[model samples]
Target: MRSKEIVIRDVEKTFQTRGGAVQALSKVNLNIEPLSFVSVVGPSGCGKSTLMNLLAGLDTPTGGVIEIGGERVSGAQEGNAVVFQRDLLLEWRTVIANILLPFELHGVTWLDRKDRTTNRQLAEDLLRMVGLEGFGDKYPFELSGGMRQRVSICRALIQRPTLLMMDEPFGALDALTREQMMYDLLRLYDQYKCTVVFITHSIEEAVFLSDRVLVMSERPGSVVRDIKIQLERPRNLSTRMDARFLDCVKEIRGVFQSQGVLAEV
Candidate 1:
């Protein structure tokens, strides 16, 4: 049940807001295996994003320790990449440049001010993987919403990160775009097999992409359920229509309703 790729032990986080102290997470504990896709779901403001920030090392826990691959996550730890709801693309950079930016920042090509040969190839491969082939010269401003997000994902993947954490990365797209992105994401994920911790509000999305789904309670949040998804791999559009897939979605929704995070309609 535990693989030690990620370990969150008795974690707690508190913020001192203008209205005094506010607890975002409490006594959270988890163990994530390497190369597994896990999704976290809960109602809005249930500390889902807070938990992600903690794991990504953007913020430290007020208490407890979080270890990624045996190293404590005390600060912005290296070897992990995160994709948020916003694409966070640089408007001036070409799509290829944006994807290769991480290597550039690492001094692979910084001082020379020239893109490294190998880095450029890796960036190109990633672009092709996401079906953005031959569009590497395009700027972020030239792209549609989903295309921009695809570039963001390429940027994240170019690093070959030890962990990939995505927080509602497709939340802004139209329904059709979101579904297409999900399918593309899973294909890339299969090829890379990096450990993934995804955060989303949609139960169907969680069920579709995850090997396990973590359900959190309301604010001062902690995971209340860790539901394993029994659906087959390489999921397709038909997977959504499968009875087993629907059952997984329904089961996660049941957890939300039971926690009073949602009301029966």
Candidate 2:
């Protein structure tokens, strides 16, 4: 088997809220293999976002360990990139500039690297890959919600990260746009073969994008089920109509139903 890209062992997190100590995560254990697409789904306030934060090393766990690429993560590493719910693009920078922001912020002088020219080409290529090629000269405000989010995705990939951590990256778009972005993201994943840990609340989105769907429980969130998605690759809108696709959706819905999260609708 391929080596694990990310490993979380018996992890626990607690917060000292105004109400007192609130348990956020308890005994969370997961091993994500290299280049696998994994989606995490759960009810609201289930610490799903917190889990992403932990993996990004933005926050430390109250207990337990997190290892990425065989090294213990103490802080954000270049190997990993995160795209949040919001685009979080700098308004002052142009599209290409925004995409190169990470390298710039890290004081990585592009001129010094042997692959500097190739890296610059890759940045432009990524923007194009997300369908933002011609708009590289435009500002973030000049773009629409979906467009800006696409730029964010390009920025995240410019680093050529080994792992991508996405927390509802497409949550703000319209239904049609969300579906398009899902396929776009899957295309990028296939091309780069990068490990992805996506956090989303949409059951259909989760089933469509993941190699495995991890169903999480409410507060003090814990994994309730880890369902493998055996669907064929290059999945698109048509895949949603497949019987196997519906089965996967129903299985996830059943988990949510058991937790009283899914209502008859």
Candidate 3:
């Protein structure tokens, strides 16, 4: 599962708008080790998601190259899955069916009986992993916001992707639900051990779940700091109150303050 090494070299992106070209990223370089959890944080409109899109193969860099597993990224490839803020579940589909949708989209069907059976079993296991075991027969409308995101996470994991790109996956939930989801996500990360590149605005959230937090500059965003989280793993709600966690939060906040991005926080 830790077979891929993400190498982003001298990446740049310029988007064409009605006014003129808007340079979003410039001379960005990143090297994500295999099986590491990395979070990206910066001000609004600072190309954080733009960088993620490039890594996910949804958009191309105007310059430089991105390589995963030592292969140049030309388009969306297997072993890469994305989860956004929204659940994006099929309302008509049952919970298990929604989780199984990826297999169908990838063209797995009854013809490959063995693979299909194995994947079905894996789906059930993932549902249990995310604490949604008995809800498989339920529909998305029947579940709460947190439960829906849990299904979304299970759907992403069903692909067995080596790299999981998440853009604010829990941004929509309330505070309590969001806190619960964070712990649940850590459990999933411990089990899966895949490389994760997460984008978020919450400094505390980034510090809680990440092995390293990459901070970007303002507009035309570039990596300003890559701070390693010193807190031990198997972290929980109590970990947030630790002295080191508070220190890490303050350190990242200082970077933002220097950039005049403190007004938003």
What clash count does candidate 2 reach? 0
TM-score each candidate.
Answer: 0.95, 0.94, 0.95
lDDT of 3 by residue, 1-265 (tens): 5548999999999999999999999999999999999999988889999999999999999999999988999889889999988999999999989999989987887699998888879999999988888898898999999999999999999888899999988889999998888899999999888999999988999999999999999989999999999889899878999999999999999999888888563
lDDT of 1 at 25: 97
List pairs with backbone clashes in candidate 2.
none
- The CA lDDT at 218 in model 2 is 94
Q: Candidate 1: worst 10 consecutive residues by lDDT?
A: 109-118
Choose 1 or 2, whichever is better by TM-score. 1
Instruction: Give the number of the best model, judged by lDDT.
Output: 3
Error of 1 at 168 (Å): 0.4
lDDT of 2 by residue, 109-221 (tens): 86778555666677889988888778888999999999999999988988777889999998899999999999999999988878899999999999999999999999989
- Please give the CA lDDT of all the candidate structures: 0.90, 0.90, 0.92
- lDDT for 91 in candidate 3 is 100
Error of 1 at 131 (Å): 1.2
Clashing pairs in 1: none
Candidate 2 runs further than 4 Å off = 1-4, 110-118
